[model samples]
Target: MKKGILILAGIFAMTFVSCKEDAAKKVKEENVEMAEGRDAKNTDFPVMSFAKTEHDFGTINEGDVVEHKFEFTNTGKAPLVIVSAKGSCGCTVPQWPKDPIAPGAKGEMLVKFNSSGKPNQQTKQVTITANTETGKEIIKIKASVTPKAKPVSGTPVSK
Candidate 1:
C-alpha cells in the first residue's frame, strides 16, 4: 500500500511539471511576437538630443536655491513626448513640458536644487521618461556648496 501511494504522488508531480512546461512555452511565444512588433516600430521612435547632458553650478552657498534649464531637440521622425521627470532627492525638483514636441522642434526642462542642508561637493541626477528611443534619458547637475560657519561654544555674542 505504501509503494502504491508513492507511485501516485510521483505521477501527480509529473503531471504538474508537464503543465508548467506547456505554459512556459506559450509565454515564450507571446514574448517573441511582442519583440517582433517592437522591432517593426523601432524606426518610428523619437530621438531626444540634448545640447548638454550635465550642468555645473561651480560654487554655491548653503541655503541657496538655484535653477537650470536643460535644452533638447527632437531629432527623430516621430513626435517626442516626455512622460515624466524625476530627481534623485527631495531637495532636487524638475519641470518638463507636458505637450508633445514635433520632429526637429526644441524643448527645455528646468531643474531646481535647494542647497539648504547639502554641503560640500554634490551631484544630482534627473531621470526623464519619454517616448524617445531607449525610453529614458538622464541629465546631471553638480555643485560645490560652501557650508555656513557655526558659532563657538560658550562664546559671548556682540551686538
Candidate 2:
C-alpha cells in the first residue's frame, strides 16, 4: 500500500512540473515578442530591481503606525511602468508612483502598516503589477506587536 501511494505522489508531482514548464515557456515566447520593436540595446521587457523585498520592524507597541519606503530601480533598457500596488488588507497601504521610471532611474514605494487592533506577529504583503519581465512582484512587511502593560490595582503611578 505504501509503495502504491508513493507512486501516485510521484505521478502527481511530475504532472505539476510539466504544467509549470509549459507556462514558463509560453511566458518566455511572449517576452521575446515584447522586445521586437524596442531599442537595439535593450530587451523588450523592463526589469525592476529593488534594494530589499522584505522589512522587519522587530517589535513595536500596539496602536503604532509604521511606515517604510522601498527603493527600486529600472535596471532594464526599457522604462518600468508600475500599474498598481495593492496591499493585503485595509490596515496595510502602499503608495506607488503614477509616472513611469525611465531606464537607469530610481523610484520608491511608500508602505504603511497600522497596528490598531492587531497584535502578535503580523505580516502583510503588497502585490505590485507592472510592465516588467515577471509582470508582478511582492513585498512583505512584518512586525511583532506588544500590547501596553497594564497596572495593578495597588500600583502607584510614578511621576
Candidate 3:
C-alpha cells in the first residue's frame, strides 16, 4: 500500500507540472501575436508621388528671376498635408499649397530662383516636408547663366 501511494503521488505531481508549462507557453504566444497586430496599425501617414522631380532652367541671363511649378499627386489612402517648403539658398524660394490634398488629388509647389547674384552653372535643391510616410521630398533646379559683356574702352591709336 505504501509503494502504490508513493507512485500515485509522483504521477500526479508530474502531470500538474506539465499542464502549467503548457499554459504559460500559450499565454506567451498570444501576447506576441497581439503586439504584432498593434504595430501593423500604427502608421503615421501615407505615401506620395511627384509628377516632376527635376527642373532645368537651361540658360538664364544674369539678374533674371525664374519660376517653376512642381506638380504632385497623393497616391496613398490618407490625406497629404504639406508642412513647409525650404530652399537650399536664399537666392531660391519655395511656396507650397496650404490646403490638404485628398487621396488621388493633385497639388503644386511654386519655386523661384533669383539669379541676381548667381552666376555660371548653378544647381539648387528644395526640401518639402509633408504628412507622408517618407516625411520629406527633394526637388532640384539647375541653370546656366552667361555673364554680361564688359563695356568697351575708348582709345585712340595711329595705324
Candidate 4:
C-alpha cells in the first residue's frame, strides 16, 4: 500500500510542476505581446480632446430627466474608434457615435441622467473604451436633486 501511495504522489507532483512551467511560459509570451502592442500604440494612437470633462446640472427636482452633449475632437494622427461607452449606473445612459472619426474631426456623445428615486447629491461617471493612448477615458456628471415630499394618508379631515 505504501508503495502505491508513493507512486501516486510522484505522478501528482510531476503534473503540478508541468502545469506551473506551462503557466510561466504563457505569461512570458503574453508580456511580450503586450509590450509590442504598447510600442505600436505609442507610435500611432488616437487622442481624445474634450471641450469639457465634467458637467453640472445644478439643482433639479426628483423625477427630472436631464441630458447633455459632450463634444470631442480627434486630435491625433490616427482615426478615433470608440469601442464602447458605459455608464456607472443604470440611471445614467450614454450614446456615442458608432463610426470612426477621422483625425482632427469632431464628435459628440449624449448622456442622460434620470433623477427618478434618486435624491440629494448625485455623481455619475461614463467610461469610454477606445484605441487611445490610455485605452480608456472617463467623463462625469453631477447634480443636486430635491426630493419630493411624501403625502400623508389617513382619515379625511372635516372641511
Best candidate per TM-score, number?
1
lDDT of 3 by residue, 1-159 (tens): 999999999999988777555556557877889999997897756556888899999999989999999998888888888899899999999999898899888888899999987879999999989878778989999999877665667865559
State model 2's lDDT: 0.90
Residue-pair clashes, model 2: 1
What is the Cα-based lDDT of residue 75 in candidate 3?
A: 84
User: lDDT of all predictions, in order shown?
Assistant: 0.94, 0.90, 0.87, 0.95
Candidate 3's clash total is 0
- Model 2's C-alpha root-mean-square deviation from the true structure amounts to 9.0
Count clashing pairs, candidate 4. Answer: 0
**Per-residue C-alpha lDDT of model 4 across residues 1-159, encoded as one tens digit per residue:** 999999999999998877555455556777789999878767678899999999999999999999999999999999999999999999999999999999999999999999999999999999999999899999999999999998678957779
The worst-scoring run of ten residues by lDDT in candidate 2 lies at 19-28
Model 1 over residues 38-118: C-alpha lDDT tens digits? 898779878999999999999999999999999999999999999999999998999999999999999999999999999
The candidates, ranked best first by lDDT, are 4, 1, 2, 3
Q: Candidate 1: lDDT over CA atoms? A: 0.94
Q: Locate the minimum summed-lDDT window of 10 residues in model 1.
A: 18-27
Off by over 4 Å in 1: 1-22, 27-41
Where is model 4 more than 4 Å wrong at Cα?
Answer: 1-42, 153-159
Give all TM-scores, in the order shown.
0.80, 0.67, 0.69, 0.77
- Per-candidate clashes come to 0, 1, 0, 0
